[model samples]
Target chain A: MLGAPTPVLSIGSGSAYANDRLAPAVAMADSGRVSVMGFDCLAERTMALAQIRRRQDPSAGQDERIGALVPLLRGYLSRGGKVVGNFGAANPDAAYEEFAARLRKVGLLGVRIGVIRGDDVHDLVTRLDCALPELGTTVGALGDRIVSANAYIGAAPIVDCLREDAQIVLGGRLADPSLFVGPICHELGWDLTDWDRVGHATMVGHLLECGVHSTGGNFEDPPYRLVPDPHNLGYPLADVDDGSVVVTKLPGTGGAVDELTMKTQLYYEIHDPARYLTPDVTADFTGVTIEDLGDNRVRLSGARGREWPSHLKVLVGVDQGWKAVGEMSYGGPGCADRARRAEEIVRARLDAFGSDIDDLRVDLQGVGSLFGDRLVGGEPTEVRLRLAVRTPNLEAARAAVHEVELLYFGPAGGGGATGSVVPALGVTPAYVPREQVRLETEVLET
Target chain B: MKLREMAYSRSGDKGDVSNICVFVYDQADYPTLVEQLTADVVREHFGALVQGTVVRYELPNVHGLNFVLDRALGGGVSMTLRVDPHGKAFQSLILDIDLPGGRR
Candidate 1:
């Protein structure tokens, strides 16, 4: 309940996804506009990939930028600026360890760091045999092939941590918007169960969670929609009041925060504007109104909320094995024809592997790699023939791409040949009872 | 005319689903967009690329239309071997849709 009479909470965006540029985040921290900054460092597939890394090395799966980030965050933490992020990725304890060590190294003693756990429901989903709707099977069906299962958690643990005076909070699979929602609610005295207030906070969180997306990172086009300083686009910050918020970026930073930018991001990944399902609340953004305040500021309001969903959505990571990709360029007058011939040769060669290769695709880059025949245009002067394959066996994946390398001797005029294989992991969604997840937040003073 | 003449779009992915939102640059064209860009229309425009259902949601207040295409990506983002896994290019591909009454 620590809020001024006016009660405006200013929170800024730190990082949008794993490996997001640190310079912009540093800029936001030093700008002095926000007292709290939320960083969303995980995407749908990010956790699965992080899990793969963890499987290989016990201490390697957390966000890799913490070492570089901690020194950068020193000034902000000294000024009493709070930070929250899903930097835990697949490892919350490792993230906490790194944060503690780094903060102590920087002489920032007495900083309270909160570590949230229990989002990992791999064992829970397995025991419950949760149904994986996308995979058309149960978690038990996947057996040991299922690598990890992490629930998309809400702002509840974050609020709990903040209530205990955590200067920094990090967790695994914290829903992107919840990173901001917790801070806003915690700072403004908004109750976690207050649906409308949480919804309003969620709307503001959604706006800033994507970092530069709310500003202008992905809004630029050559002629139709253009923003200034796209290369240096700044992350968005929100001035949140009770029912409304004004989202804007730092001064003179690239990108705009006008009505169009706000509208596009508001519904960017949202399927239904009226009912955006998040762990915190069933937020309704349909009634939201956007007003351009000029100079990269947009005021948005009218977000309502209903009761939270009883079931929580969990991302189950399945061991998809390996994916191999090989490409070769064919140029000149008969490039498309030569590329097709190259594809035929590669296909016939790949047929020997048979069922070892699960999914096989051969496409000409400029011809029909994307959109298929829907948008395949005229004959191109040059096109790259790309052969992609997926398999449970890495040897088969490597051999499949090795066939592409053999193309140098098979097809005429095939130049600049390349081949590579990488471990692949697929993530699917499953619903579990919310009560099944028991979040534990431990606050540590450095 | 193509929808590109009157609107802008962005596509995002959640697992195998792709949601592409289109907002008209000019508010007057919103109704026409709603009338012409139905789920069926967008499905047909995408053809075999979209193996599942197409759902269109209207944003009247913001003059926008959101199209959620199910099983649109070749599996999920990391699983899909397609050059554009997340359908990041779908935004541009959607602009190529034919809108009969769009302003040139």
Candidate 2:
């Protein structure tokens, strides 16, 4: 028999990204307010890099914090707290094994671990020659340059694993919100197909998925927007009930979780509010309402949902050769002009490589790099000229980097020159039928 | 008055697509936000920073508008050579847009 719905399901966010600081996660896990913690460890940028790391070492693509995190979460885990994370970035087996070993080391026996596979449809997309909408080409056209393709799986596997009493659940490229939705649905006894309830669950998941972003990580601006104690910002947690959720941070934590912070996060990564598409459902957040409950607590509701998308999004990684970045500072009188001259020199020098370099640009940092011509600041006493290049030709890439280091000879007062060359893994999106990705879930006791 | 004086914004990305949600600090100013901060105004302000379409969606419940800009991040992180590949700085840039009049 299914368990009755939880009157209120409390879940907290652990890590927002792959390299996110673990201190906040430690605090969130230690708090007794949440029964479940979700870690969204993979991002659009991290996924591509994870693929490269896995390619170099067969067992390297999992979340690096698994060892440290396991110990930090020991107290909560021992007390029966559950975890759901996309910890298996490019390799699920590696993540699963790490969790098993870490749990054993922490003296936590009989912990059930769930492994969700089949998100890695690298071969399936290649066979189907999936059309890469971003690249405007098919998978077969790229050939071996295509390194990896992982679909953003939904909460089904997580819910399945939880049903089997999995204490920790992990998978590769599990949609960020799904990491939380899975646990919420499982504990709340909410049906996967119930559009409205799932939407509410997704709303809660969205609120907690970004960790401090929901609290105020990127929400500060001097003289305009400010939060209390910005340094000690606490990770966000949710108090989810039937149709509504209250988003707040731990007491005494830096940052505010008021109506403004919650609203910003509500539509943070969402594109179309009316059709916010996830692997599980087409969520509609247009009518979502936010009520400030004071004391760093805000209630959110009114998120609706329709049917899920017909196809799942697959993030296909392309081995885009190497990226070279070179920078040098020009200071004192006429710094802007000198920086412009430096750019001209680099552009002219890089032209020798011709079309071998896919893309190249040079920008003056203090003057116009970020906003282009839109927001031009005053003539700075010093400006840094940054030249970046993407090229299939490794030697050309290295040559571009070397040229920047040689800038000391050309521009007057051009000191602090720095250059770097690294493999650039580009990602493009492709859609495949949901049935094509046959996701499998395995729950086993450690 | 400047939009930044009465409003705040946050930008996010999905590949080449960028979304910025702007909300008025006061609920009473929601109408002015809708009237002055149209998609066209934002597109023009962004200029070449955005190469594709700019579509705006209103969130009356939250007193905000979400603007989705296509081809906004200069081909995104890996492929683009832009400094801020994610256009994260766009949020600060958008707030510079002028409001209809001074409320002070």
Candidate 1, position A30, lDDT: 93
Per-residue alpha-carbon lDDT of candidate 2 for residues A96-157, written as tens digits (9 for 90 to 100): 99999999998999999999999999999999999987778999999999999999999999
Off by over 4 Å in 2: A1-6, B100-104
Each predicted complex: what DockQ?
0.83, 0.83
The interface root mean square deviation of candidate 1 comes to 0.9
**In each prediction, how many residue pairs overlap at the backbone (N, C-alpha, C within less than 3 A)?**
0, 0
The root-mean-square deviation over C-alpha atoms between each candidate and the true structure, in angstroms, is 1.9, 2.2
Binned by DockQ into CAPRI classes (incorrect, acceptable, medium, high), candidate 1 is high
Model 1 per-residue lDDT tens digits across residues B14-65: 9899999999998988889999988888999899988899999999999999
Q: What TM-scores result for chain A when each predicted structure is judged separately against the true chain A?
A: 0.98, 0.97
| Candidate number with greatest lDDT | 2
Q: TM-score of model 2 relative to the true fold?
A: 0.97
Residues A5-29, model 1: lDDT tens digits: 7878889999999989999999999
